[model samples]
Target chain A: MISTTNESDPNPNESTLVEASPRRAWYRVDDFLAMGLAALIIVTATVSALLVRPPNIPQLVQDHQTSKVRLQQLDPSAESFSADRKKIIKQQAEIESSIATMPLKGWLVRPGEWKDDPRAAFVKSDKSIATPLLATFGVLLTLFAAVSFVQGQSAWRFALGFCGVFGLALFSYVLAGQEVVKHYNLEYALWAVLLGLLISNTIGTPKWLSQATRTEFYIKTGLVLLGAEVLFNKLLALGLPGVFVAWVVTPIVLVSTYLFGQYVLRIPSKSLNMVISADMSVCGVSAAVATAAACRAKKEELSLAIGLSLIFTVAMMVVQPFIVRASGMGEVIGGAWMGGTIDSTGAVAAAGELVGSVAKDVAATVKMIQNILIGVIAFAVAIYWVSFVEPRDDGSKPSVMEIWHRFPKFTLGFLLVSLILSVIQSQGIEGKSLVSSIVDGTTKSVREWMFCLAFVSIGLESNFREYRKMLASGKPVILYVCGQTLNLILSFLMAWLMFSKVFPNAASELLAK
Target chain B: MRFINTGVLKFACACAVVVAVWMLVLPVVGDFPSVRQRIEGNRAAGINPTAVFYTDHPAMADIERSIAAKVNAPTGSFWQFSARRPK
Candidate 1:
C-alpha cells in the first residue's frame, strides 16, 4: 500500500488545503488584529448611509485570477499590431456608438448662468471650516506606529518617511475635503525642496512597514479599485467628439513623450524611463501605479515617479488656465485644451473652471473620455512588453511565458473587474441603485487599502541613506521640465481645434479679455 | 526532512502573518472611516457639483447645471457601443 501510494498521489491537494502565500497569514494573530480593525471600520461605515460601500472581496480576487486568459493569447508584435489595432478600434467605435444615445441632460450641470441651472454654486451655504486638526490626529497616529516599529540604517529615514506620510496625508485629506479631489498637490514640490535640504542630514525612513510587503498588497488592492472605477457606463458618457479627441491624443502623447525621454533627453534608467513614459501617456498617478506594477518597478521608483507626476500635474493645473485665457482661446476651446493637456482629471477640471462656462464642460468631458484609455493602455503595454520587447532580445531575453509569470498578478484582477463591469453595464445593470452601491463599495475598499499600502511601501523602500546616494539630479529634472512644456503646447493646440473651430459655445471673447 | 519541512512551514506562516497585517487588514482598519467620510463627501458633492460653494442661493442652480453638462457629456468610455452614435 505504501509502495502504491506515490508522490503523484492527489491526496495532498485535498489534505494540505494549500493557501496562497500572501493570503495565508489571515489565520494569524496579527492578521486577526488587522481584521478586527477592518470589521470596526465596516461597522462604522454601515452606521452611516453617507459612507455606504458595497462588497469588494469578490472583485479583488477576480481581478488577480482573471489575467491568465489574457496572458495566454497576448503576443503582440508588429504583425499582430494590425489586427490588434483594428479590433481595438472596432471595439471603441461600438462603445462610442452606444454612448451617443444618452439624453445629453443627465450628466449635465450648466455652469455659467446662475438663473438657468439649479444646483449649488460649487459651494453650499453650510460651508464648513477646514478639518486640518483631525487630519493631524490621523497623521500623528500613523507616524508614531510606523516610527516606533520599523528602524532603518539611521534616524533620517525614520524622520523623513514618517514626516512625508504625515504631510501627504494631511494635504490629501484637505484636498478631498474641498470641492474636488485634487489627486496631485503642489505641496510635493515643497517636500522635494525640504527633503533635499534635510536628505543630507540623513534621517533615514525605515519604520515598521516593509516596502516590498506593502507594495505587493497595495498594488493588488489598487488594481481591484481601479477595475470598479473603470465601469463601462462611465465611458458611454463621453460622446462622439470626446471619443475622437481621446483617440487622437492619448497614444500620441505616450509614444512621442517616451521617444523624447529616450532620444532627445537621453534618460538612462529603464525603470525611470518606463514609468515617466506611462505617466506622460496616461492618467498620471493611476498610470504610474499600473505601469510600475506591471514592470515590477522598485518601490522607490514608483514613489519618485508618482511624486514627479504629482508635481507636474499641479504645475499644469495652476498654469493652464492663465495660458488658455492669455492665448485668446474661447471658453470651449480653452477648456478642451486644458482638459486634453493636463495629466490629472481633478487638475484638468479645476483649470477648466478657472476659464469660465463652456470650457469647463468641454475640458472635463475630454479628460473623462481620455481617462477611459487607462485599462486598454495598461493591458496593451503589458502584452507588448512581455511579448515583443522580451522576444526581441533572442537568447538573452526572458521567455514570453516567464515574462507573463513575472507580470504582476493584480493586473489580472483589474482586467477581470473591468470585464465584469463591461458585461453588467452592457446588460443595462448600470445606473441602478444596486450597481451603484456595488461600485461605491468596490471603489471605497480600493482607495482605503491602496493608498495606505502605497504610503507604507513608500515609507519602507525609501530611506535617507539610499535616497542620498542614488539621486543623480541633473538630466532627469531637465527632462521633466521639457516634457511638461510639450504637454502644455500640444494640449492648447487640440483645445483650439475642438472648441474654437468645432463646438465653440464661443464664450471666446468675454473669457479672452 | 520532517524538521526542515516544519521549519519552512513556520517561516511561511510568519511572513503571511506580517504581510496580511501590513497590507489587507491594517489598511482597511486605519483609513476606512476617513474613506467613508470622503465617499459621502464626494456624493454630497456629486449630487450637486455646484453645491460646495453656495447653499440654497439662486446662483448655485445655474452653476450646478453648467457643471453637470460638462461632467455628464456623452463621452465614450473604452469600447464604444454601436447604434447610439452622438449627433
Candidate 2:
C-alpha cells in the first residue's frame, strides 16, 4: 500500500515555520551551514596549497638528473636507446612497487601516493602545518553546527555531541578506505552507513546527537559542488563511438527498466525503481544519490539501491576481466564492455588495466563519457517526477508554477556549476591542466568531505526496520538484477558494435603507440 | 505571483550571487598561478603531483599489478563465489 500522494510532501510539516505561515525562510539554516562549510573547505585548501611550501636542494638535483637521463633514453634513432628505455621503465616500476608498501599516512596530503602521476600538478605539504589545519577545520565545523543546529536550545552539549558522532563517522570512513578495504571495493559510503547503523540501533542514538544529523542538507551541498566535476567537454574525448556506447545504450536501459518495474513487476515504490534503474544503467552510488534526491526518495530506498550496487559492482569488477580473457576479447572491446557496465569509475579503471594498458585507457575514457550523463539524467528525472508522477496521482495537471515549486532547487545549482565550468574550459582562459588542478585541489576534495558528512548523517538517522520493510517485497532486488542483466547485454552489444564494427580503424589508431 | 513566497525568491537570489561570484569573479581576480608554481616547485623537488583521475597517478601501476596478481593467478578465481562452492 504505497501512496504516490506522499511524493508531493515527503517531509511534510518538518519546516520550522508555522503551518499557515506565508513567509518561508529564504534559505533553511541547514542550507546556510552546509554552504558555509563547502566555502570554507575550498578557500582553505586552495589558499594553503597556493601559499605553503619548503625548498629541498638535494631532491631537486636528483630529479633534474633523472629527467636529463630520461630525455636521452627517449631518443629513438640512438642505438641501445630501446634497451635503455626498458631498463628505466623497469626501475621506475620497482620504485613504485616499494612505495606501495609504505603505511598510510594520518594526514590526507598524499604526496607519496601521487608523486609520479603526470596528469595534474601536485604540491608537497609542510607537515608542520597539518596540526593547525586539522584543528581549524574541527573548530569551524563544530561552531557551525552549534550556530545552525543548537542556536540557544541545548548550548555546548548539542555542539559537542555532534562533534563526537561526526568524528566517529569520519573514523569509520578512514578505516573503510584502508588499502585492504579499498582492494575489496568496500567504499566509504557503505562503511559510513554501517557504522552509523551499528551505533544507532544498538546503543540508541542520543537525542542531542540526532539533532546534528542533517542528511539532506549535507548531500545537497555536495551535489552542487559535484556539478563542477561533471564537465561536459570530457564527453567528446573518445569521439562518436564512445558516445554511442555510453549515451545510447544508457537511456535505453534506464527507460526500459523503469517501464518494466512499473508495468510488469508492479513495484510499489517508484523512487526505489528509478534509483535502481539509474544505478544499474548509468553509474552507482552517485546516480542513486542524484536520482533519489530528484524524486525525493526515502533514505531507506537510497540505502537499498546503494547496497545492491556495491555487491554487484564488486562481483562485476573481478568477473568481467576474467570473462574477457577466457573469451579472447581484445583490450579495447573488453575495456569498453567493462567500462559501460561496471558501476564505479575507479573499479572500472582497475579492471580495465588488469586486462592491459590499452584496455585501461579505453575503459577510463568510456567511463568519463558515461559520467557526463549524470547531469542530464538528474535534470530529466527531476522534471519527469514533478510534471508527471506527483500530478497524475493527485488527479490534476500541474501548472508551470506548481512544477517549478516542486522542482529540487539544488539541481539548479548542480547544472549551473557544470554549465559555468564547461564554459570556462571551452573559453580556454587557462590551460585544461589548470582547470583540472583547481577542481582536484579544491572542489573535488570538498565534495568528498561533504558526501562523507551526508552519509554519516544518513546512517545516524536511518532505521534498519525501514530497510527491512522496503526489502520485504523483494521487487527492488529483482528489479536491480533484471535491469543489470539488460545493462550488461545492451552495453556489450553497443560497445562491440561501435568499437569493433563501426570504428575499427579509429579503435586501432587510438590503441597504436 | 500572489502565491509566490519571498523566502524562495531570496534563496534563488542567494544562489545566483554565489554562482556568479564563484564562476565569473574568482577566475578574474584570484591567483591560480600561485598554486601552479607551488606544484611545479614540488615536482622539481622530486615529489609527484596529484592527479584527478586514478589512472593518471603512478598508483596506476600498483592497481594493475595488485589486481593482476589477484585476478590472473591460476588459483582462486571468480568461480569460488559460485552457487556451488569449489572443493
Question: Top model by DockQ, which number?
Answer: 1
**DockQ, 0 to 1 scale, candidate 1:** 0.03
User: Which docking class does model 1 fall in?
Assistant: incorrect
The sequence of per-residue lDDT tens digits that candidate 2 reaches over residues A1-513 is 121112222132132100111124544433344445555544454455434322443353354347435744365446875466446545544432322221112333211212122111122343343453365346546645554543233434445555755675556544443333344455777877766765566555666566556567667777777777778876756667678888999999999999999999999988888988998888787878888878877777777788898888878877998999899878878988997988876667766756776687677667777877999999999899888987455698989987876777677778876786687666431323233444655566556656666677677677789888888888888998899899889988887877666655555544443
Interface RMSD of 1: 18.8
In Å, residue A349's CA in model 2 sits off its true spot by 1.0
Error of 2 at A172 (Å): 2.0
Those runs of model 1 whose alpha carbons end farther than 4 Å from true positions after fitting are A1-184, A187-213, A388-400, A426-432, A464-473, A500-513, B1-87
Tens digit of per-residue lDDT, candidate 1, span B54-82:
11122222332333333332331112332
**What's the lDDT for residue A432 in model 1?**
28
DockQ of each: 0.03, 0.02
Report how closely model 2 matches the true complex, as a DockQ value. Answer: 0.02
